[model samples]
Target: MQVPDVMTAIEISTPGGPDVLVPGKRPVPQPGPGELLVKVAAAGVNRPDVLQRRGAYPPPPGASDLPGLEVAGEVVAAGQGATHLIGTNVCALVAGGGYAEYAIAPAGTSLPVPEGLSMAEAAALPETLFTVWINLFERGFATEGEWALIHGGTSGIGTMAISLCKLFGVKAVVTCGGDDKCAAALKLGAAAAINYKTRDFVNEVRQLTGGAGVNVVLDMVGGDYIARNLAVLADDGRHVSIATQRGVTAEVSFLDIMRRRLTLTGSTLRPRTLAFKTLVAEELRATVWPFVESGQLRPVMDRTFPLREASAAHARMEGGDHVGKIVLTV
Candidate 1:
């Protein structure tokens, strides 16, 4: 198929707010060697996209300046070395450029859309699922019957983490802002949902775990939550940070970490090497995709907007009222 000359995309001319996300036409990108040019059907709205739009998170070297990070689309054209994925329906975790009608993806990062999921739903899967899978399971060493705590339980990453915990039979405690969010977390298989506004999360987690504390913590809220997260960690627990919406710097006790023998680590997917991302994508296909295909796991969608309305999607995410992933249909 012949690729088009121009494509519709949401662009950020200046960084400030969601209003900066303006839809415009841009030259369509071509696939390089080992890449596939995808006709994007839908794209996910992620916190990283919001950060990029605000000029807080810039794309890495040789990546698109566009804000989007995940896309579900059909392979329209494949570059050299990517012939096997031509004409496939796929959802991929991208470094950037998903807010456009066509985006180029590394062939290895693309995965077949799981059975019974819509394109929009698939678009929502890659970023959150990949983040949760890598952090909670791979990095944190979360295992069956282990106790885990996830902060921001109503967010996209939180919801995905909770479901994975349940599927693997790991006990999970989640922290959210309200009773409704808490209830939603529990419905998604969280063993307990603590409303951070009304209760002390560290205290609640301690009580729920019979005073032994949790074995792992998936924390997106940094700063003030850091001290508390450490306080609630079980001996040899792993604390993985994925975001720092509250602030990155925190003054905490190293003695506490030393006493508990805790493991503290964090990762951002966009800056990772293509080889590393390919490995993560392959791991997801082998260990997690089957569960999605079999209905053992599902994408929790909060809302969707048209491709031109990317600003509205970001606004909704900033509002912090959403319970799951938000999407933008291209």
Candidate 2:
């Protein structure tokens, strides 16, 4: 394959809204040591991209200034110690630089695009999958036969959480904004879905779990929900915060935490070291890749936009009506 000297990438012209994402020309980056240069076929659109576009989450130092966090494509070149991966299809969790025709990826954080998975689906997996796996299962200690309370049941992370929970035998009870979204969640194997707009989720969860409460809460919404989330936890339950979409600060009662032996934790993946992400990639390849290869697990794809229309893709994600992952196809 003839790799181009220059390629098109979506750059944040200014921090503002979707319109701030503009296509621009840049030199095609060569992979560094232990890295692969991928010809991007598709890139996943994530909420963090929105936050970055809005000037909230800046890329970590020494990372690309581009917005995308995940991409799936063919490896066209490789740096020393990573030459074996050249010519293979892969999906990678990148810190940045995914929204482009050519992007560099660390070989360690890249996973083979397994059989039966489309590029778009592969692109969608890394961010949400790594997030849910680390926070919900590893950090929160969710196990088989346990119950998990997940918010934003229709979002990429929520939907991935539901699928993983279902596959691992954890009953997932999710909250959505509307009846239609709730129905979608249930149809996607959620044990139960609560319409938070119409009902109090705390009460509904209590009823659904027969007053035992959930074993873990995978929360993306922060603020007042933190207190409410803790209230609905079973004895020794865990609360893992991944995002603070509502707000960051919250007032919680330490007495309640002490009484229940509850645990609260959170993580942000972007700033984590490449070694950590590489380890996560290896874990997923061993544990979760089988499901992906067998077609038993797949991302819920909502839509795809052309590479030039990155702004429109961001708009669709922000509109809040899409039920699943959005992709930008090159």
Candidate 3:
């Protein structure tokens, strides 16, 4: 296939609300060595994209200014060493530039789209899958037979964690904003789900664990949740933060951490080195892809928008009523 000279993309017009995201045209990005040029069918709308539009999270230096984290498409061309990927359909975790018709993906960060998934569903996989595996399974060590407490149970990451727990043999508990979301989380395979609006998450977790606490905590709500999150962990429990939806600054107690031997860790994907993303891709292909193919691990899609209607998609995401992943279809 001949790669196009120009492509449609979403650009942040200003540092403001959802209205800032505007459809624009730009030259299609070329894949460099060890990369693939994808003809995007769809892109996943993520919280990071929202942050970037608000000018809270800038693209790491050298990355495109476009706002999107994951995409699903067909490889139209490839760089010298990545010719093997040409003509393949794939889903990729990109640093940026995903909200476009044509995008470049480092070969290592792209994977074959799971069999029997729609383009929108495949587009929803990369960001949440990568984030969940790294935080819940790797860093937090929420392994088989252990217990994991996840915040934002209706979110993309939360739904992934909850659904995978059954397949992985981990007991998962979660916090959601409403009764409907709590029910949704449970239906997706959570052992338990708490409505944060009507109940206290810390108390529910404590009760669910018989006061022993969870083995790991996957939290995005930082600030005030920190102390409570620590309090709800088992001895030596791992607490991993991926985002700070509430606030960042907090007052932590050394005594609490020292007494329980707790570990608090967090990570952001975009700024990491190419080698790190490549390694993550390797790990996912080995450990998670099978689940994806077997129908055990599946994407939870909330809604989709035409690629040009990206601003409306941003509004939907910021509205916070949608559950699971939102996508942009080209």
Q: Compute each candidate's TM-score over C-alphas.
A: 0.98, 0.99, 0.98
Q: Flag regions of model 1 displaced more than 4 Å.
A: none
Q: What is the C-alpha lDDT profile of model 1 across 164-236, one tens digit per residue?
A: 9999989989999999999999998889999999999888888899999999999898989888898999999
Q: Please report the TM-score between candidate 3 and the true structure.
A: 0.98
Model 2, 215-240: lDDT tens digits are 99999999999999998999999999
Model 2 residue-pair collision total = 0
User: How far off is residue 19 in model 1, in Å?
Assistant: 0.9
Expressed as tens digits, the lDDT of each residue in 145-211 for candidate 3 is 9999999999988888887788889999999989999899888899999999889988989998999
**C-alpha lDDT of residue 105 in model 1:** 88
Q: Cα lDDT of all candidates, in order?
A: 0.92, 0.95, 0.91
Which run of 10 residues does model 2 get worst, by summed lDDT? 109-118
Query: Candidate 1 — worst ten consecutive residues by lDDT sum?
Result: 107-116
Off by over 4 Å in 3: none
- Candidate 2 overall Cα lDDT vs. reference? 0.95
